[model samples]
Target: MRFFEATHKYPFDWETVSLASFRKYPNDKTPHVQHVEVLNQEIDPETGVLKTERLIMVKQNAPRLMMKLLGGSDSSYVLEYSEVDPRDKTLTMHSTNLTFSNLLTVGEKIVYKPDPEDTKNSTLFAQSAKLSADGVLSRFSSYIEETCLKRFHDNALVGKLGLEQVLHKILAEKRQERGGAGNMAA
Candidate 1:
């Protein structure tokens, strides 16, 4: 198993960042993401936390070796689970690939919260991921591990770019609504 973690600072407040995260898909930067289907969404009556389950379809660009081993699949599904705590100003999300589990599995967790030092205008985003391969691929474990880790790292950057794009769009809309100058704060 290989693990990786990344931290990013967003100039937008936590609320804005959280809202944008939910709308991150369907953006140009992440064309690999094909669709998102919400399986369930509800608010906990006792804690007032919002919980959601979603299925996401992504077009796979598997390596030649992986494609050969997995019969050349073109897409895969991921299951996403998330919880939002308004009172705590936190959003926690976890996702796992539903396909190719035996050959390769990628699981990721993300936490979004208000930056204590600059809660009004800044948010902190942290993510950690685990990559593992087993089963018939054990003989090629090293190769598989390396490929999966590199892919995950590259995709992490793309994910961040996609979120930033969504945040910018949201800010632009808010500015238009206020009839303010075209310049954005960040």
Candidate 2:
């Protein structure tokens, strides 16, 4: 098994960051993410946290050899569960690949919260993943994990850019709304 983790600071508050995350997909930077379907969504009665589950379809590029070894398809499905705690001002999500489980498994966790250093204006983004291979391909597990780990890292950079793109849009819309409201009041 192999592990990967990283953190970033978004120049926005936790609320904005969390909202951007929901709209992060369908952006140009991560075209590999083709579809996202919400399986269920609800609010916890006691905690008041929003709970959600989603099914994601992704098509990522991989080495030809690896692709052929893993059924020659670049598309895979992932199941993700997430929680949004308004009281704590945090959003956490965990996901795992559902396809090719017998050959490999990719489990990922991500979190967005107020930055301890700059709580008001910045948000902290953190993510980690575990990669493992099994079945008759155990021998090549290291290679598979290493290759996928590299791909994962590559995707991570673009993922951040993609989220930022969405965040910028959200901020822009908010500014426009405020401007329009101010004009009306004038």
Enumerate clash totals for all models, in the order shown. 0, 0
Query: Per-residue lDDT of 1-186 in model 2, one digit per residue for the tens?
Result: 889999999999999999999999999999999999999999999999999999999997777887776565788899999999999999999999988777779999999999989999999999999988865366788888888899989989999999999999999999999999999999
Q: Using Cα atoms with residue i matched to residue i, what is each candidate's TM-score against the true structure?
A: 0.93, 0.95
- What is the RMSD of candidate 1? 3.6
lDDT of 1 by residue, 64-169 (tens): 8678767857899999999999999999999999988867788999999999999999999999998888654567877888887987898889999999999999
lDDT of each: 0.91, 0.91
Which residue window of length 10 is worst by lDDT in model 1?
A: 177-186
Candidate of highest lDDT: 2
- Residue 52 lDDT, candidate 1, scale 0-100: 99
lDDT of 2 at 72: 59
Which regions in candidate 2 have their CA more than 4 angstroms from the true location?
A: none
